[model samples]
Target: MSNTRPSLTLTLLQAREAAMAFFRPLLNQHGLTEQQWRIVRILRQQGELESHQLARQACILKPSMTGVLGRLERDGLVRRWKSPQDQRRVYVNLTEKGQQCFVSMSDGMESNYQKIQAQFGEEKLQQLLGLLNELKQVKP
Candidate 1:
């Protein structure tokens, strides 16, 4: 039998879990799921985005983004409107409340990041991020 190699997929997931452990509690305190936080962060960073674009950037499926966006809208954290140029396309943006939420959560998030940075040395963390970005450029 051919020797089996360590699973890169599993290793990536484990690393994700380890990284998320740092932010999960803060997200819980803010009553946000990881997906919800991802959407808001993407919208905040990119300004307005089409629904599909938001889903892509947030790494959420298009179908699931609809539901998550619904909750965010209901909670007054996001606002959605039909695109001016395309009636069928929808755009989403953060509301003032969402901006405030991000601001409130920023310090705690930064603290957690700092703790992680301390644990994995700043240089190593930067190197990992750089490598990950490079990996993302690889074509299937």
Candidate 2:
């Protein structure tokens, strides 16, 4: 057998595509785009955060997050208020509705994760996670 080479990014893209196929549908059912869900989950976990912090944590662009946060606030999923110490700074927090949505999404996510775990099995999943972490740790 001959040794073959594959582009690392191509393999990474393939992995991301396959992963998204499984995760995206679950996200859609909860009335969120993946970016929106990312924001919701982050806010749910972190209590409250400024928009800049949310953008950084979500790995989403500031422009998109501005729109997302606006919609979330308009829909009552989030509330934003000027910080007491700095009126120019705004903080965001999950509303009761947002918390409810996060909880509901969590239940669905648990089942989805279980299904993926059963499909991939533990060993392969661990290996995949390790590989991904290794990639993350590489310096830019």
Candidate 3:
């Protein structure tokens, strides 16, 4: 039998889990799921975005995005409205509460990032990020 080792996909996922371990506690303290945090972060950085755009950026499926948005809206963290130009299109933005939440969590997030950088080395982290970005461009 041929020797079997961990596949690249499995290795990547393990690495992701390892990295998230450092930040998951902070996210939990803020009562945010990974997906919720991703949405909030993107909205904070990109301002208002269409529902589809938010989903695409967050790498969430359309159906799952609806539920996530519902929770955020219920929590008063986000507000959604239909576009005036195209009622079929929906836009989402952070509420004042959401902005506050992001600001409050920013420090903790930065601290966790620093811990990761210190443990993993900043140069290697940047190189890994660059490689991951390049990997995204790979076609099947």
Say which candidate scores most in lDDT.
Answer: 3
Assess every candidate by TM-score: 0.97, 0.85, 0.95
TM-score: model 3 vs. ground truth: 0.95
Q: What is the Cα root-mean-square deviation between model 3 and the actual structure?
A: 1.1
User: Which segments of candidate 2 are over 4 A away from where they belong?
Assistant: 1-5
Positional deviation of 36 in candidate 3, in angstroms? 0.5
In model 2, the clashing pairs are none
Clashes of each: 0, 0, 0
Two-way TM-score contest, 1 vs 2, winner: 1
Order of models, best lDDT first? 3, 1, 2
lDDT of 1 by residue, 1-140 (tens): 99999999999999999999999999999999999999888887999999999999899998899999999999999999997888999999999999999989999999999999999999999999999999989999
In what order do the candidates fall by TM-score, top score first?
1, 3, 2
Model 3 lDDT tens row, 66-123:
9999999999999999989999999999999999999999999999999999999999
Candidate with better lDDT, 2 vs 3: 3
Pick the winner on lDDT between candidates 1 and 3: 3
